[model samples]
Target: MTVPLLAITAWSGTGKTTLLQQVIPELNALGVRCGLIKHTHHEMEVDTPGKDSYLLRKAGADQVIVASDRRWALMCETPQQPLSLAELAARMDSSVLDLVLVEGFKGEPVPKIVLWRRGVKGGVEDLLDEHVIAVASDEPLQTGLPALDMRQPAQVAAFIARWRAAYR
Candidate 1:
C-alpha cells in the first residue's frame, strides 16, 4: 500500500513547479489522488505573526496545530535536525493518496523523472543516474529512455498513470 513517489526535478528556472502546476490537474482528471511535498532550503514561516499558533510556537512550543472547518496546518520547529525526503514521505497518509509528487530532493535515490533542457544545470547528473525513470524535455533527447513532452501535460500524466498502474 505504499504511495508511489515521483518527482519533477531540475535546476532553477527549469520550470519544475510550472510543469507540476499543469500536471496536478491532469492527475486529477485521471482520478489520481495526488499529494505534493515541496522541498525548500531557505528558512520559511508557515505560521503567521500575532496569530495564536505563531505566538505559542515563538514561546518555545515544539509544535503547533491550527485548524478551521476546511483545513488544518501543523508547524513544528526542528532546531536539531532536518528531515530527509524519506522522512517527510513517511509523514504522508498513504491511505488517502495514489501518488506523491515530490517537487525536489534531486539528490535522493527514488523513482523520478529528470526534467531537462539545454542551458540548464541538470543535464550532467541526469546522465550519471540510472535511477532516473524518464526524461521530460522540450527538445529531443538522445537517451533511449522514454522522452516526454514537457509542454503537453496530458502526455506526461498518461505516462505517470501507466507507470503508477504498472507498479501495482
Candidate 2:
C-alpha cells in the first residue's frame, strides 16, 4: 500500500519548518514512521564540495547514492526539471514509512496544511488553487477551512490522526 502524504506549506519565514520539527517528533512518539521532503527555490547542494559524491556529480553522474554504517542518502542531479510531488515520493521507501510529510510544493495535487502568520508578505491566498485542506495560524482567516492553533502540537497531531483514521 502507498503511504499517505501531506504537504505542510507556507511562505518564507512563516515557520513551516519549525512547525514540522515539532510535529514530526510528536508523531514519531505515537509510532508513526514519517519521511520528509523539502522543496527549495534555489540550488541546494547536499554533498559538500570536494566530497566523493560531489566530485561524482561534478564529473556528470546523474545520480549518486552515499551510504555509511548509520545512514544513507541519494542525490539526484536534475538542474532544471521539476518533479511532481508524486514523482518525488516514489523515490522514498514506502514500505517503511507510514506517512510522507512534504515541506513545500503547495501547488501540488495533495492535501495541505498551510501556515499563516500575521503581517507575512505572501500566503496561500495568491495561489489561485484549492489544494489547502486546513490552515494553522496565530490569527483568524476569513477562508472557510478549519483554523488550527499554531501553538498546540497535540491539536495538530490529533487533526492529522483523525483524518488518517477516517480514511483508513
Candidate 3:
C-alpha cells in the first residue's frame, strides 16, 4: 500500500520545522510511524570533511551509506538535479511507515498543511491550490481551509490523525 503523504509548507521563519518537531513525537505516541522528507534549496552536508563517509563520497561513491548501532544515514549524489517530491518518496522505505511528512515542496500536488506566520515573507495567499487542506497560523487566514492554531501540536496531530483515519 502507498503510504499517506502530507507536506508541511511555509515561508522561511514561519516555524514549519519547529511545528513538525513538536507534532512528530505526538504522532509517534499515537503509534504512527512517520517518515520525513525535507527539501533544501541550499547545499547540505550531513558528514564532515575527513570523515570516513565523507571521504567515501569524495572518492566518488555514487551513494554512501553509513550505519551504526544508533543511527544510519545515506548520502546520495544528485548533482544539481532537483528531485520531485514523488521521486523522493519513491526512494524511501515506505512499507513500514504510516505517514510521510514532507518539510517543503509547496508547489507539489500533495495534501499540505500551510504554516502561516504574520509578517513572514510569504503567506497562505501563496498557496492558492486546493491540495492545501489545512492552514496552521498564528493569526487568522482568509481561506475556507481548516485553520489550526500554530501553537497547538496536539490539535495539529489530531487533525492529521483524523484525516488519515478518514482516508483509511
Top lDDT prediction, candidate number = 3
Ten-residue segment with the worst summed lDDT in candidate 2? 122-131
Q: TM-score, each model? A: 0.94, 0.91, 0.94
Q: Which lDDT values do the candidates have, in the order given? A: 0.85, 0.83, 0.88
Per-residue lDDT of model 1, residues 1-168, tens digit only: 788898777777788899999999998999998999998878899888998889999999998889999998878788998888888888889999999999877877888888887898646355437668888889888777888989999999999999999979
Error of 3 at 33 (Å): 1.0
Residues 38-67 of candidate 2 have per-residue lDDT tens digits of 999997778999987899889999888899
Better of 1 and 3 by lDDT: 3
lDDT of 3 by residue, 51-110 (tens): 988998999998998999998888889888867788889888977899999998888899
Sorted by lDDT, highest first, which candidate order results?
Answer: 3, 1, 2
Clashing residue pair totals per candidate (backbone < 3 A): 0, 0, 0
Return the clash pairs for model 3, or none.
Answer: none
Relative to the unseen true structure, what is the C-alpha lDDT of residue 154 in candidate 1, on a scale of 0 to 100? 93
Q: Which residue runs of candidate 2 sit more than 4 Å off their true CA positions? A: 127-129
**Superior by TM-score: candidate 1 or candidate 3:** 3
| Candidate 1: Cα lDDT at 64 | 85
| TM-score: the better of candidates 2 and 3 | 3
